[model samples]
Target: MTHYRSFVALGDSFTEGLNDPAADDRGGAPDRFRGWADRVAERLAALDPEFRYANLAVRGKLIDQIVAEQVPLAVGMRPDLVSFCAGGNDLLRPGSDPDRMAKKLAGAVRDLRATGAEVLLFTGVDPRDTPIMRRARGTFAIFYLHVRSIADLYGCRLVDQWSMQGLRDWRAWSDDRLHMNEEGHRMVAAKVCDVLGVPTEDDWRMSWPPRERVDPRVKRREDVQWVRSHLGPWVVRRLRGRSSGDDLDPKRPDLKPFG
Candidate 1:
């Protein structure tokens, strides 16, 4: 069996467990403070009494920020096992540059690999089928594919989080219609355990619930309105010689793409 003395997780909100409702109820409150990475750590501890784990994920963090902050912290930990779940926020807005995102992801992988840690990279689910969530899914797929290719290039293990349970079944998500709920968190924890060769209880099995479908026309109108409110001015300004890069300094922490 594969042996890892310590585990570390690095990435963004999905990695941090943003939408899990159960996190508030749990004594440790990982969902609010921890994330999927912390949940995976909890599962690992349950499987092996001796396993040690730490989560370094932060909410709303992009690949570049992770590399600059979390990557060094993870390297310092000298963990044997490491997993990363990111790229969701990168897909939130339409016309966000995929090539730039991919480049930043590649840097993150390379930096982590330099620490000599065995890394597991997770690709997020495609949200295309969801009426209001469709546009971002296309961009998500592109980002995921590129990250997978980067993992292959770096000889890292790739976890197919997008294909895991709860993605196809919308009921796994929370009432907000974006984040995953308690059941969703459990499913994610189970999948990470499987990838790490950790044993889990039978109760860990996930069930897909019926999804609510919305009218495509309504979703389209909503998308148009969202874009007009968020990206319209930015696009117009870019066309008029005010570039996005210029308007929002890359170094500014609050300059992320608004959904």
Candidate 2:
């Protein structure tokens, strides 16, 4: 496995760490915030303090926007390693074309790889596992398959996030049914380390313990609340042509020596 001295992450909310709030005050950029990429960077920095990292992901970015904005910035950084996650938001758009999105993503991968970075890519997860995303399961699958094709064509390292059975488990997600929780992010970090030959203390594929089931009535109420809190706003945004990342800046914009 190559020991990356410099790394930069690109894509969306999943890579931004979202609900997985940062825990440690490590000078490491990824660790200054909590997210799978940050966790991975934390472990890599531990192995080699010379490692430096940056995260350029913002929530709700579309594939074309990522290619147009983040790709150039990442190429400029010229990190030895780049982990990219995109297309999820695009796939969710109404009347989205999976092939077109995939093509744009492939182009982005090509540009980023031209900078001589070992680009890593991820596929969208199964929507059937989430109540909110269920309506778009078919679309997500189309996007996911194209990602696989792009990975093969470009020789980019592919982390088949969709194949991770553990991710389907509700424990791997938050109530929003979109982003992963802190525990889920940690699991993903461990998985990425395992993929890149970084040693980990435990397996990320472990299943959740069985627990008593919640009442069906409570589940219904939770669903109603989710529609009100998350889905309703999402609809409004679509209607108003706005995005979650409309005014958001990259969480960690520069790559510097990490603790």
Candidate 3:
């Protein structure tokens, strides 16, 4: 198997491991989403004691921002491998241009690959299981294909999250219906490792037991609650032209040795 002694990940919340809180996150400046990148790092470190990993992902960054900021730092680090996940937040907005974003991302991939490092890119997941996410599925699918085109053009090994069968269950999502929970992140990590040809333990395809039936009225009530807690706040943020990553720096900014 090919060995990657150093790894660096960059992108938004999904790459940052959102909603998947760390087990022993000491009180810190910003929240930690112990995402799939960290898990993959751990596995890599276990195989090679000299392994080092860095994740330069922040929450709510657009493709242009990620390209402008994270790409340079990642290229400078010169890691043997780089994983990038971006452009989802842009698609989440109404009428966000997919071609321009795909071009920006392709440029980043081109630059990163010029450093002679292996590049890994991911596609947007199929969120049709979530009612709100389903509404934008058509638009998001176009974005997904744009990414696919970039991956193909750049010769990047793509992690097709949209094709993941395990994500069909609603339980794979967090309370916000946007980010994935711990289990979903784990499955993603496994999928990444599978793509990278790294060994893993658990079966990511394992789904939860059947859910009990819920009354239509109860489901409607939960939908209202979801709006109050998650959707409403997101809309407010969008309206204000603010991002969750605003005023926040990447959690693991430096590329260094890992545990």
Candidate 4:
């Protein structure tokens, strides 16, 4: 298997690892966030002492913003491995065209590929059963197909999130119903390792233990609370043309050795 000496990840909140705060056991700073990319980097670092990684992802970035802000830096870093996951934020907007977004992403991928780095891409997870997101399942699928096509055309590695049945469970997601929780990030890391031919103890497809079903009344109350706490503010931001990441920067900007 090819041993990548360096890896750089580019995209928005998912790549930035929102909602999944860094744990003490992971040796990450308590104030910082640690997502699946960080988890993947840890495993990769174990394979080689000199392995370096950088994450140029921020929260609330649209596809265009990512292409403009993150892609160029990733190219300059010249890492042997690259992961790109964008366009989900755009898909959330009304009248967003998946085809156009795909074209933009394809151009970025083309440039990344020109650098001879092994590019990795991800499909948005299945959102059919997800609240609010379920409304845009059709759009998400279109974009996912485009991503698959790009991966095939460019010979990049793919993490097919749509096929990961394990993520379909509510336990895999955070209370916001947008980003994944700690368990969700862990599973994603395992999946990435599997794709990169890295040996890992965790299995992305591992089944969850049996649990009692939630009462329908309690579920209804939670839904109302979610709308008030999460969905309401998100809609307001869209109206005002703002983002959650407006003041945020990438947690790990430099391509340096990872522990």
Q: Rate the local accuracy (lDDT) of all candidates.
A: 0.66, 0.85, 0.87, 0.93
lDDT of 4 by residue, 3-73 (tens): 99999999999999977887566575666778999999999999999999999999999999999999999
Error of 4 at 82 (Å): 0.4
Per-residue lDDT tens digits of candidate 3, residues 159-195? Answer: 9998888877778879998898888899999999998
Give one clash count per candidate, in the order shown.
Answer: 2, 0, 0, 0
Clash pairs, model 1 backbone: 16-35, 17-35
User: Which order, best to worst by lDDT?
Assistant: 4, 3, 2, 1
Taking all chains together, the TM-score of candidate 4 against the true structure is: 0.96
Per-model root-mean-square deviation over C-alphas: 7.7, 2.7, 1.9, 1.8
Model 2 lDDT vs. the true structure?
0.85
lDDT of 1 at 97: 82
Error of 4 at 225 (Å): 0.9
Question: CA shift at 215, candidate 1, in angstroms?
Answer: 13
Off by over 4 Å in 4: 23-30
With a 3 Å backbone cut-off (N, CA, C), the pairs that clash in candidate 2 are: none
Residue 134 Cα positional deviation in candidate 4, in Å, after optimal superposition: 1.2
In model 2, which regions exceed 4 Å deviation?
23-33
For residues 1-259, could you state the per-residue lDDT of candidate 2 as single tens digits? 6688998999989998877876565553534347899888888898887999999999989888888989899999999999999888877777889888888888889998899998988886778867656898888888888888888898888888777788888887777888898888888887888778888785778788886899999989999999999999998998999998899999889988764
Error of 2 at 220 (Å): 1.0
